[model samples]
Target: MKKFIALVSVFAAVLLVGCAPEVGSDKWCENMKNKEKGDWTANEVRDFAKHCVFK
Candidate 1:
């Protein structure tokens, strides 16, 4: 049971980390551009503009 729980935890961590590009990276900027504008949080907008646009 403990081994199964550890395996599930590791899988969950990988899924979360693998799904999104690192924030403020070029890949993240491109991802933000493609995602719906309404879905973005205020901080994402700020970071995207700061890192992706102005840079």
Candidate 2:
């Protein structure tokens, strides 16, 4: 049980790290650029358009 718990904790941490990308950072902007339009929620698309685009 203890080993299982430790494994689960590590898995959870990996998931959390993958979910959080700093908004408007270079990495986030690159992800936004490469992702299909349908992959983003409306709010996320709006934010990317506003913050990630260059004129």
Residues 1-55 of candidate 1 have per-residue lDDT tens digits of 9999999999999999999888889889889999999999999999998999888
Model 1 is weakest, by summed lDDT over 10 consecutive residues, at 21-30
CA shift of 22, model 2, Å: 0.3
Best by TM-score: 1
Runs of candidate 2 with Cα error greater than 4 angstroms are 1-15
Local distance difference test, each candidate: 0.92, 0.85
lDDT of 2 by residue, 5-30 (tens): 99999999999998878887878888
Worst 10 residues of 2 by lDDT: 46-55
Which regions in candidate 1 have their CA more than 4 angstroms from the true location?
1-14
Residue 36 Cα positional deviation in candidate 1, in Å, after optimal superposition: 0.1
TM-score of each: 0.67, 0.59
